[model samples]
Target chain A: MSAVVITVTSGKGGVGKTTATANISTALAAMGKKVVAIDADIGLRNLDVVMGLENRIVYNLVDVVEGTCRLRQAMIKDKYLPELYLIPAAQSRDKTALTPGDMIELTNQMREDFDYILIDSPAGIEQGFKNAIAPADRVLIVTTPEVSAVRDADRIIGLIEAEGKYSSDLVVNRVRVDLVRRGDMLSTEDVVDVLAISLIGVVPDDESIIISTNQGRPAVLQNGSLAGQAFRDIAARLTGQTVPFMELDGHDSFMKRLSKLFKL
Target chain B: MPNDRIKIKGTSNGLVITLGAGAWPRLVEELDALLGERASFFKGGRVALRVGARLLSTADIEAVGQVLSKHHVTLWAVESEAEETRTAAAELGLEVELEPRPISPEQSRPTAGDTILIRRTLRSGQVVEFPGNVVVIGDVNPGAEIRAGGNVVVWGRLRGAVHAGMNEELGEMAVVCALDMSPSHLRIGDYLALSPADDSRTQIVPEMAFVHDRQIVAEPWSV
Candidate 1:
């Protein structure tokens, strides 16, 4: 089966692009799909660490592109999931070591072997971001609810549209329901209105996500975490499933009480 | 085939280059080579490009202008049949129409108003400029800008910066009207004003802004 190459990018740094990529890849693999996650951030590679496979890396994406290692030799299989693989970036090299053409050719070679190929794009609108999206069938833009992050997301969306890639979507991360309810933060609707793009997922702010990252494991593997559920829902949506969005604002009970009072 | 893409003709005003149909990058490359071939003949010359029916973005037009400027050619105007291309040229503060040929009085004067009607939203980082009046049917989001020689009107929200009455020759009588009139910065002629920080309430009536006593002011739009 041919793989769908999805690129996850954020124009601003520390907005959880790497976290989202690792979690989504894990969620998709847990659903019995063969998934390969590529860390396109060459100089600052962290996907291997997040996936808890740093010690297993014999080769990397730069090695494969430079023809020093075979593609199979560079792919580090996950310890728990047999269907998942990780192609970590070269720590010693920079973004210039890989070009857009190399990314496209490399992904094309794996198209027939996997069901999903997710590329974790580097921060900024530079060569690394271009390389990640070069072979993408769809793009997921990750952003926080802050104005600065939303502004950067808008710029990235404009660039993606200008490149003639029409399948780009948005994923709002680190959304605090309490802040939204208190009118201190931008709501999901406000972000969607400004960006004018379809919303794929809304990941709430969770402390377990940081804990999971520190322990070198994606939070999506934790069944009890709300952030993990959000990633799972996003993965389900990616696989053509219609899962309802989680209610994060704690307003459902309030609304129900208000309706009951009106009836009484 | 390469030579046919760019046809240069000398005129009394300047050189008029007719750019043939093709991709924008290839056209830029060919124009670069053509300029390089006859640098002395084209040096210190004004150019009016005749791009027939091709819609060019701001970046594409800027690239072409840069190529000409590198060879000491000043791009004074751009003549195009496409409305988008004309608007793009006008946005760069370049004349959309070339210098008039010897014309009869009837052909020289027209009866229509010089106003541009834009029906699309101006997103962040997009700029629309014209030497005449401008009427937009969509929202002007934050970071977008509009510079007009005359009046400006927005049927939707006006949260972006706008400079009206840019051409002093046209008389400083320009006004800016918007359905929701909270702009980051507003200018009428030489006067400038910023939206009040605490005025976050939604506007119920349309508002018009104009220069009054050497300062910009906004009032309820009536007549």
Candidate 2:
């Protein structure tokens, strides 16, 4: 099966690029699709830690590229999904150790083995960033609803366009729906207006996400979580499903509850 | 200096690098030597090579650009008689001109301030800033900005921030028009108007904004 290589990037750090990669990869694999997750953040390898596969990494992406080990030897299979695997980045090596050509060749070799390949890109708009995006058939930009995050997302979108990849979509993470209703936080509409790109997902601010991430299990595997549901919806949309966005506060009103019951 | 070659003059607009007809790599080496001779002088200068009759391809143009950029010079335009060279320059976002614009006394005089027509929709985060009249044929999405020195016109929806008649020299008069006008913020001269929260109601019709009684006011398109 051929893989669709998608790079998850945020121009600024801490906007949840790695988290989105883990969750989306988990969600897609749960749907019975073979998925491979690659951590492109060379020196700062956190995707492995987040996925709870840190100890399983004997060889890494650098080893595969350097011919020190076979490609399959570096892949650490996921604990939950048999079809899911992760190729962790090398913690000791620097970003300069690999070139954009190396990444393209690596992902090209992986396309035959998986249905989806998610590359967790490092922060910034430098060589590391270019290396991550070089092999991407699609891009998923993650940003918080804050002004700084949205502005950086705009710059990143412009850079992606400059690279002649126009199919990049956005994912708004950590949106507090309560603050949006109170006019305190930026709404999905506000962000979509600023970035001017197609929205793929809107994940609410869920405390469970933080807890589950610390436990090395992404929240997307937990059923009924709002953030998990958003990730699942994103996966469905990626698969060309037309799933409508869920109302996070559907239990707040009786009328909303009635509408939810009948699925009207 | 031993191998005689064509003369080139670098100007403010672009580089006028000259090349002599000879062996390909030798001519290219001569070109590089000329550029390295005045590296500081060509810094930040866009290059428009003047190749007299050289058949050059896309790869040739791109290689020169890479070499020039390493020396902090930008290849902006090219002047060539070869059809292949001109086509290659255009593909690389460079302008190919047969003759440069003459800067005679009359030609040096500033032309009348002209309007720039923007045909595409200005999406969010896109800023259109110009010193002359600006016309947009498409929607100005919210968070986008348009700062103009003269009148601004939008044939489509204008929901972004706009400042018309900016710059003190432009005087205290400006006009803005849109088919559906509900801008997040609108400024005419020095006055500002914050759009209402329910912009949906105010955006469904044609409107114009101008300074009336020293206040920024929105009026019906016909009025």
Best by lDDT: 1
lDDT of 2 by residue, A1-264 (tens): 899999999898999999999999999999999999999999999998888888898999999999999999999999999999999999999898787767877987889988999999999988788889877889999999998887678767756653446678899999987888889999988988757689999888888888888999998888646788789999999988999876755525633564576685
User: Any residue pairs clashing in model 2, and if so which?
Assistant: B47-B76, B48-B77
> Candidate 1, fnat value?
0.06
TM-score of each: 0.75, 0.65
Position A258, candidate 1: lDDT:
48
Q: Tell me, by DockQ, which candidate is best.
A: 1
Error of 2 at B115 (Å): 5.3
After aligning candidate 2 to the native by TM-score, how far in Å is the CA of A9 from where it should be?
1.8
Put down candidate 2 lDDT per residue, B93-194, tens digits, no spaces. Answer: 576763555543243222225465766556555576666677898778766788887878999878789998886666357789998888889887788889
iRMSD values, candidates in order: 6.8, 14.0
Evaluated at residue A242, the lDDT of candidate 1 is: 95
TM-scores, chain A, per candidate: 0.94, 0.94
DockQ of each: 0.11, 0.06
Candidate with the greatest TM-score versus the true structure = 1
> How large is the interface RMSD of candidate 2?
14.0
* Model 1 bad stretches (over 4 Å): A251-264, B1-56, B59-86, B89-120, B133-135, B200-205
